[model samples]
Target: MSSSDRLLLILHIGFAIFTLGPLTAATMATPRFIRNQNLVVVRYLNRTTRIYGIGTLGIFLFGLFLASGDFAKPWLSASMTLFIVALVLLLIVERDQRKAAHLLETAAAKAAPAASSTKTGGEGAEEGEKAEKAKAAKPAAPGADIAQVERGRIAAMSGVVALLWLVVLVLMVWNG
Candidate 1:
């Protein structure tokens, strides 16, 4: 195959991976911890958060390289346009994840009550402790649910991206 073809393949795979990796991570790892309130998993995703951004950057740069060049047939332009919009939607999805992550982190670090409380050796102290625990037990307001309606939007982005790839294939293999 030609160098351009090799590049296209790399770009296409990289872009798709970049777009879909967090989706998999969020969907898979999230459910594992959301119910249990696990910190390690959240930290794992947060500390390495740059992967999502860098992968997205890779997708934008590589996908544009593939699209702007006339490697594909002219009839595939509409498909390319869909791919572009799909990338945009993917970026928005990433932003929403970040927002959710931030909220989760905020909830986590403060999950326990402040340490300044006096646990004096008395029944009154026991009552105070129970009250504090009760107050802290209230569920935190999350920025977004992983299972929210926006997730549907994210899935639609993937579907559109797949559609674009199909269009490109059709234009190149069957129609060209």
Candidate 2:
């Protein structure tokens, strides 16, 4: 290969590693954090998702630069299609993470008042019994249930993205 081709190939690989690796890690961590109701980690993962979203552009641009000479290759076309699909999956995962974070935040807010009231020892015995019964009578929060479902979706989608990346890597290495 020529020097320019070599440089582009190197940059493409570098961006792929830098962008996809952390993105996968963050995406994987997101569901766990959401399951734990750890909003802090969920928010951090969301930020990581955004950062890698920009990094994905670098991967795409560098990949296009490297593929310019062989744009007609079937493998390249397939890889491009897979990359686009993976990007869409990543965006969906990111959106789910944001939703999970919001849900956790709202759950925390709703619990705060009850926690503070209990800590202050302000309620009499009958009132305390009523409060406890009221809490028990409340249905499961929809946010928590939705967040759990979203986390499962994110995990499944992230796995598909990883598999797509693996296929792309194989195509590039063996068929490019």
- TM-scores for all candidates? 0.49, 0.84
Evaluated at residue 52, the lDDT of candidate 1 is 58
**What's model 2's overall lDDT?**
0.84
- Residues 1-176 of candidate 2 have per-residue lDDT tens digits of 99998998888889998898999899988888887677899999999998997798888898888777777888889999999999999889889888988888888788767645753345575677676677655534554564777889989998998898899899988986
* lDDT on C-alpha atoms for all candidate structures: 0.54, 0.84
Q: Whose TM-score is greatest here?
A: 2
RMSD of 1: 5.9
Superposition error at 114 for model 2 (Å): 1.1
TM-score, prediction 1? 0.49
Best candidate, lDDT-wise? 2
RMSD, every candidate, angstroms: 5.9, 4.6
Worst 10 residues of 1 by lDDT: 27-36
